[model samples]
Target: MFIAAYVLTGCMHQPEPVVTPIQQLNTERYMGTWYEIVRMPTSFQRDMSHATASYRLNADGTFEVVNRGFNTRKGEWKTAVGKAKPIDGMPAGFSVSFQWPFSGGYYIAELGSNYEYAVIVSDSHDYFWLLAREPRLPRWLIDRTLARAHEWGFDIEQMIETKH
Candidate 1:
C-alpha cells in the first residue's frame, strides 16, 4: 500500500520538461546586434516600433542585452537593459533578468548556420522573437523561417513584424 501510494504521488507531481535549445552554439559568433524581425506581444514591448536587440559579452562570462525601439505614439526612443547568465547543460539558453532575483528563460530554438538569424522561444511559450543580423531579410528567407517556426509548434501568425 505504501509503495503504490508513493508511486501515484510522484506521477502526479512531475514538472514539465524544459524545452531544448540549439546545441553547440558559438557564443562569440552569436554576439553583437540583431534586428528584431517580429515578436509575440509582451507588456514591455507594447507601443514600440523599429525594435532592436544587442548583445555583448561581459568579462565575467555573462551577457548584457540592450533592447531599444522607437515609441511612435509617445514619439520617443526607449531602451531597456538586462543581464543574462548561461544555464548549465544548455549552450544557447540563459537565465535573463532585468531585475534582481527575477529571471526568465531565454532560449534559442533555431539559428542560422552563419549566425545571420535566430528564433528565440521563451520557456513558458508565452514569448517568441525572430531576429536577424540585418534589418531587412529577403522575402523568401522570412517566409521559410516562419514556416519552420510553425512546424516547431509556435503560433507564427501571432508574431508582428517590426518596421525596421
Candidate 2:
C-alpha cells in the first residue's frame, strides 16, 4: 500500500510542460498578413482551407487580429475579428480574444530571423500553428519546424497542412 501511494503521489506531482517563446519580437515587422501553412485541428476552423491571419496594430498598442479561411464544406469564406493584447514584459506573448471576456494565449515559440516563418503555441501547448509570409514553405523547413514542435511537447503527427 505504501509503494502504491508513493507512485500515485509522484504521478500527481509531474511538472507542467514548458514552451519557450523567442526572446524578442518586433510587432511592427510582425504585422501584415500571414498564411497558415499548417495547424493542429481546431473545432472553429474545421474544414478550413486557405487560412490566413492579418495583424494591424491599434493606437493603444494592442493588435487587431483578423483570421480568414475558406470553408470547403460550406463553400464560403469565414472571418473572425479579434484583439490581441500584448503582455507587458513578455515580448512574444499576447492574450487574444475572439469572443469578448474570453481570451487565449498566443505565444510565438519559434520565429525566423527575417520574420519569414513562425511557430505559434498557446500557454497550455494545446494549440499549434505554423505560419509564413507566403502561402507555402519549403518542405525541409516545415519538417524541421515540426520536429522542433515535437521537442517542445507538441503532437506533430496531428498537424494538418493548410491548403492555400
Candidate 3:
C-alpha cells in the first residue's frame, strides 16, 4: 500500500511537457531591424534599457546579428556582434553565439504573415521574445501572439515588457 501511494503521488506531481509548433521562417522577410517589445530576462540583458536586435544576411551565407542596448547601471551603450548559422536539416532553424565560441539556439517559432512581428524561442523555451519593426504593436496582434504562446506551452506571464 505504501509503494502504491508513493507511485501515485509522483505521477500526480510530474511536470508538464513543453510542446512547440513547427516553425515556418522566411529568411528574406526576417532580415531587418527588430525592436524588442518584450523578452525574458537574462543575465546578459540585465539592467539594459532601449534594447534592439538587428539581423542581416552576410555574403558568406551566415547571419550577422547585432544586439544593442543601453546599460543603465553603467550609464553607457552596450553592443555585441554575433554570427548565426542554420541548424543542420532544419528549415529556418539557427544557432547564435557572441564573441565566445559557445552557441545557443535561435528558433523562429512564429512569424507574422506580413513580416511585421516575430516570436522567437530558445531550445529550452525558457527564453522568449516578441519583436517588431516598431516599438508599438497592435493590441489584437499582441493578444494573438500570447494565445499562440500559451498553446505552445510557454508561460506568457513571464514575459518582461521593454520600453524599446
Ranking the candidates on lDDT from highest down gives 2, 1, 3
Candidate 3 CA-lDDT value: 0.67
lDDT string, candidate 3, 1-164, tens digits:
00011111111121221334345666767887888877766777778778788889988768888888888899998888777777766565666766444566666667777888778776555667788888879888888888887787778888677765
2 or 3: which has the higher lDDT?
2
| Alpha-carbon lDDT, every model | 0.71, 0.76, 0.67
> Tens digit of lDDT per residue, candidate 1, span 43-120?
677777888888899999798887888888899988877887787788887777665545666778789989998877
Model 3, residue 85: distance off in Å is 0.4
RMSD vs true structure, all candidates: 9.9, 9.8, 11.0
Error of 2 at 4 (Å): 41
Clashes of each: 0, 0, 0
Over the stretch 1-164, how does candidate 2's per-residue lDDT look in tens digits? 00011111112121221477778999999999999998877777889899898999999999988888899999999888887778767788777777644566677888999999888877555578899999999999999989988888888889899988
Better of 1 and 3 by TM-score: 1
Tell me each candidate's TM-score.
0.85, 0.88, 0.80
| lDDT of candidate model 1 versus the reference | 0.71
**Number of backbone clashes in candidate 3:** 0
